[model samples]
Target: MREVGDSAASGAGAGDMSAEVMVAGGVPLRRNGDGSWSEPPYPAVCANGHELGPYRVTIGVSHCRCGILHRTAQCNQCGATYYLPRPTDRCESTALDGRHG
Candidate 1:
């Protein structure tokens, strides 16, 4: 049996990586015979209750001009965009410093 993190056996190298990998929380996703990735373990539904599937979602890496690597997902149904791991740090100042003058 192939061990976890074995990129060679899992076909999860640079070229073979899929968005399902991130959705699965780093677990290598299975590839179907037709070159499509299998569904992830947990459901990834948007706020609008749109389930993200192979056909209903588009996932990819976005190179922001700020030099940050952003793994993004877009719901094909409603055209909603998402930044994987969600940009929670944007409001860190408000969350961290809870004092107002």
Candidate 2:
């Protein structure tokens, strides 16, 4: 096998050449195979031209008014909308000195 640092150590500071790394907003951006860097965590179009989301929206429900443990997601095939029950336990950010119920 070849030595590990033989190549990297030789090319230090000239641009590592090992990998192109970029970190933003606690997320890592990578280079694409097409010689393009990825846009930050956002919606993107697919190869077939369909919009897709890399980020997600997480809804935490302490208790559902519908008496369900986890809220149900209503799928609208035509509109593609998901409706969840309202949250019962109210809470505010600890950074903002808000109280939790």
RMSD of 1: 10.0
RMSD list, candidates in order: 10.0, 13.9
lDDT, candidate 2, 1-101, per-residue tens: 11322221222222335444454322334445555545333323433444444332222333333333332232222222222322336422232223332
lDDT by residue for model 1 (1-101), tens? 22344443335433555412323432335655455665333348866889998899888655443333456678889977776434444322121234321
Best by lDDT: 1
Number of clashing pairs per prediction, in order:
0, 0
**Shift of residue 61 alpha carbon in model 1, Å:** 1.9
* lDDT: worst 10-residue window of model 1: 92-101
Q: Candidates' TM-scores?
A: 0.41, 0.22
Give me the displacement of residue 62 in model 1, in angstroms: 1.9
Candidate topping TM-score? 1
Which runs in model 2 stand beyond 4 Å of their true positions?
A: 1-17, 39-101
Model 1 vs. true fold: TM:
0.41
Worst 10 residues of 2 by lDDT: 1-10
